[model samples]
Target: MLKAGEELDMRINELKKYDTITIDNLKEIIDTHLFLTNVFSDISGHNNRSLASKYLHFHVPNMFYIFDSRAIQGAKSYVMSDKQLRASLAPFGDKEYIELVIRLFTFQEHVKSQFGMTVTPRVIDSFLLNY
Candidate 1:
């Protein structure tokens, strides 16, 4: 989710406007979610302490909160028309939804493996059909 309720360009510009990020400033972000800093560590591959502090600013700056529904619809609309939206909203063209289904398929494979059950396309197709 986008914590900053603005375009990515605006977010970058805002950071450039500020020379440095301080420790006291990050306290408020941690107050809501302590594990927030760790989320960016793996992606940036930054060292623990120093990198974490910088990652925290990149993820969520002081006083900047997440807007759950960002300008995603607007961005998509500019790229695609209203007719395309109606067609794509249905499961077929939805990459995110398709990825979710594939993830669930993997989860099912793990659960079956635990029971010594072999996974096959037929089984997955059946499960998808039943659901």
Candidate 2:
């Protein structure tokens, strides 16, 4: 697990391996996310978070999160549609909405520490759309 205030640079490097990203990568992201409903609810799975490598595959590499209405609000300025909002979440099964808020807030903290900007999820989604 990530420690409080751990450096995100190294983590970013690791995440890049699976980052075959593009504006059109949403299709892949959507497909990947759609699998979560069955996967997360399963009692057992090889790619589950009980394993370190598997956990990273789910979170770090995919850069995906469960749903949060607040995150949708934060992403409002970036994506204009509910569709785009839905797309960003296309990677996780149903999760406690607060977890999204916490995870996203942590991401915002990482960005502020590294780049000195307090970006909302909207800014993040905008970047990902073009990234």
Candidate 3:
């Protein structure tokens, strides 16, 4: 377990090298942290997606999102249109995740530029939840 923890730590450290994660670098990051691919199952009678999201978000807030139904809906509505989001979803892979991050970053930049609202990723996430 200590070795696993150390490996995870190193993977996270690799992620830290990116000032802003992009499609170009996302694969290497995810490849290192392969555990990120685990989806929730009811076998444990627990919401593992939420658990894992919180865990990863706690570590890399700017690069990850916790997408339950509401969050996914919110992300759909947060963008200009569903079609735009759908278009972005193509060739989905690690690229899709990076695109989501890019969308959030773009949304943050848009808000800052248009509304003069400087916000953190948490605030942006809240906006996604509420928007």
Candidate 4:
């Protein structure tokens, strides 16, 4: 536990160097998230992607999208229903959290184009959670 905490601290300090999340830096952010997720998964012997996302989201609420079962299911349902949205997102890879961030970015654009309302990660999260 102590070792994991120290590692998490070190990684988070590195992450703190980024002032904001943007397309240019998103890959690096996801790499950090994967690192944290793997650290927890190593300790718990189970996948911890959601927990890692939530932790990072808590620290940088505006930057990281909160990944939970409900949101993931909602994203699947939504994409399945909208061919355009599904087509807009690139094919998923082993790192699903990266795909989720890309989906959120595409969704943000979709909402703006369809409804003229600019949405944030938090708003998208609420929509997904409630969907």
TM-score of each model, in listed order: 0.23, 0.34, 0.57, 0.70
Candidate-wise lDDT, in order: 0.35, 0.42, 0.56, 0.70
Name model 1 segments beyond 4 Å from true.
Answer: 1-94, 97-101
Best by lDDT: 4
Model 4's C-alpha root-mean-square deviation from the true structure amounts to 4.6
Model 2 over residues 56-98: C-alpha lDDT tens digits? 3345544443243444455444333334444464454233332
Indicate the worst ten consecutive residues by lDDT in candidate 4: 85-94
lDDT of 1 by residue, 11-40 (tens): 345444533222232222222222333334
2 against 4, candidate with superior lDDT: 4
lDDT of 2 at 18: 55
Sorted on lDDT, best first, the list reads 4, 3, 2, 1
Clashing pairs in model 4, backbone N/Cα/C closer than 3 A: none
Tens digits of per-residue lDDT, candidate 4, 1-131, equal 78878876776776677654555656556766777787777888988888888897887666678887787787766653334533433332225676577667667767777999777678889989778
Top-TM-score structure, candidate number:
4
lDDT of 2: 0.42
- Give the worst 10-residue stretch by lDDT in candidate 3: 33-42
| Error in Å for residue 2 of model 3 | 3.3
